[model samples]
Target: MALGHRARAVIGSIAAAAALGALLTGCSTSSDEPAEAAEQAVEVDPALRAMLPGELLAESTRITVGTESGYPPFEYTNEAGRIVGFEIDLFDAASDRLGLKYTFHDMLFDSLLGELYASNVDVIAAAMSDTAERQADYDFVDYYNDSDAIMVPAGNPEGIKNLKDLCGRTVAVLTGSTQEEALAGLNAAECQDKPVEVVQFDTDADALAHVQEGKADAELTQWSTGAYNAKQVGSGDIFEVANTEIINPTPLGFVFLKGDVELVRAYQAAVQSIIDDGTYAEILKKHDLSAGAIEKATINNQPQG
Candidate 1:
């Protein structure tokens, strides 16, 4: 981990979404619901607190968490450089349920798993997909549904509407992301002769910049991220999601090391606690991201017993 290159962002304002909600995918929020609901105090359960690892049981021990920002409506840095988003809010709510304290460490998306494996971060809060490839080595408490979208310049000059449209066209992707993997698979299986030219960047902002500057014809990212950028950046004149349809909506979660059963189960309970208390729904509703809301918390898609 590059200690010198990271910013420790104390994620705040989980419910301060009036401005944030306006820059979304046109989902409606309850104007009548006061922000006070989000600010409501969480009563920590002693049973759940007792389930935490001994090292984490201390009041002073802060769980080091890694997150890759720049994907808005999920995780991103504000103008003041504070990390705030739906994922941060969801996890914060979960932390409160478990009576745990944790801080978010923002870094390159590529370095998040590395930092987690190196013990520099105890968990990853980024909206990471719980793919079979990753589940082989990590246990993830599934929290939300995630899908990808194809974002192109406004008016979509390239006429890119779907994956087949990317043949021979340039697409910018965040390195180590599912989007990058999708491009690789496309090149190998479908676009061999005129392979889609893939440009990799370290963050979502950089990848989107490739399209904003006309370097790449399109950018592949989370559906919510693409939608938010389409609406917010350049006052809604910069980008547009070519594919309005959802693709491969998979469960995403807070990632933990494989065999870390206690930690994984503890979080599963925490997430369930929030779901039961309505905080989970409120967070998603505030962000207009209820499309990805889950009914129950799971680990790798299996209901926790």
Candidate 2:
């Protein structure tokens, strides 16, 4: 991606609502209890230490993880200015399992891959989808599954009930996202009369702002993110996820530099250890993201077409 072309910046309008509760459709996290029963810590396996790369084991005590702290419930800064979310919790469990320490750096989502390639960070934990295209540059330890949804202003004043409703209308989407590609496909297939006017923004927060301010008719984004953003921006008073067929189901993962096979293997093993020990499920449950939890800690094995 071009460093010069950044997505619209995430405005500070909704920064106060970063800690919105989970109320995503088709899922419920409000009633779920915390993953831990008490103050128990995840057990680390000494044997796993051998799996780490020589460079990692010999040089670094703490791994620096890159993340876009705008997406709530997955990874976002809380009121305390600390990044906290489901992804953070899962990383904590994985780190505990491998006896590793980590520090997270918040930056624009699109810049993460470049940062990783430049060795500015060790891994990316930005809820990034693991696609074949990305696998060409980096390896991913797949962790969760998610799909897309179209979100519009609350009450859906424009009556955008589904994807078809976006035909001939302007739609806001995050720049460089699969959502834009999906909408392009939709326009090519269905919007022959009037193609979808895709308004790309630098961040989900900005894309969300576009729709909320009536600059765009709706925004197409991940289902959970749409729901989370809706709850956060206006506490569900400004936007709501439209009733649309879930589209483009994708696997999200923690990304490592390509050819870093040993590091990938180490992280994969640590993730699997969490999954096997039930800490993975517990973390998802606590975040109300149990629905997106993967059954296994697979490598970049997801279908890319």
Candidate 3:
């Protein structure tokens, strides 16, 4: 199979580690917390509110959301030490539209699914993609899409501009991620003569550090995230996204455990309501993530179909 085709087959694995590193950093609640609040409250849609399950609105009128806050432009700690990002903004907008209150908890990314399954969280608003495999275990309210890309040191020291360039070179990837699989497949099929050397790290920061310290020639992650990290943590001078096409672009969304059709419907309607009212676009623009915007909210998005 061609690189893109092979990439599509492995995209499911990609979502598994999208924010592992970010999640590990923990939540940031600054003194200026209220300042990080959403700029505007959305007008609630009565119909959407009516669709919410009684349990969701019963006791507190709040949806407890689990988020991995270390990823930027989506969910990350700002200079002011408060949790803020386009995803948080979107959550605030959706809650307003649905006339519901929400409280976010910061935790490890790997714990998100377990928490959801245990009813510890009503929703997961992390930048999690709704891959088909995950859909089997949960329902999704799809919002935006993104892709995995490469990041290399500044000045393109290794002259690594594309996936092919990773051949015979040490490449850093998140441990247990599909990105690792994709690179391995590419090496086995296309770079047999000079197989890509793969190094797996527990977190994105560690993987990135490997690349920065010259331990690895390239690192793979969400393209937007790579750019954000390169700028925010690396000072924009230490790294640059390699000029290569993404192996596969994936849809990112909010997750709820399986069998919550009512809650799922409520969230989907609330999200679509924001899209229609232009609130979604404004939030994305505010975070410079307008490119990640999706036109309509979807349930259980399975692009591989």
State the lDDT of candidate 1 residue by residue for 1-305, as single tens digits: 12212322222333422322322222221112221235656678889888876656777556667787777888876665567788878877788778877666667788778766655567888889899998887789999988999999899887888887898999999999988898899999889999999999988998999898889999889898888888999889878999866776788999987766777888999999888888888888988889888989999888867
**What is the per-residue lDDT of model 2 for residues 119-232, given as tens digits with 9 covering 90 to 100?**
656788878888888899889999899988898989888888877789989999987677888898899898878889999887788898898788999999888888777776
Whole-model Cα lDDT per candidate?
0.77, 0.73, 0.73
Instruction: List all candidate RMSDs to the true structure.
Output: 8.3, 9.2, 8.8
Q: Encode model 3's per-residue lDDT on 1-305: one tens digit a residue.
A: 11111110111133433433455345523221364544566777888888876544553444557787766777877676667888888877777677777666677665777767766566788787677777888888899988887889888977887788888999998764557767988888889999999998766678899998898999987777887887876457888888666666878889887877777788888888888888888787787777778887888874321
* lDDT top scorer: 1
For candidate 3, give the lDDT of residue 270: 87
Evaluate model 3: give its TM-score. Answer: 0.81
- List candidate 3 segments past 4 Å from native: 1-25, 28-38, 176-178, 184-195, 302-305
List TM-scores for all candidates, in order. 0.86, 0.82, 0.81
Question: Which ten residues in a row are the worst by lDDT in model 1?
Answer: 26-35
Order the candidates by TM-score, highest first: 1, 2, 3
Give candidate 3's whole-model lDDT.
0.73
Using alpha carbons, what is the TM-score of model 2?
0.82
Query: What RMSD does model 3 have?
Result: 8.8
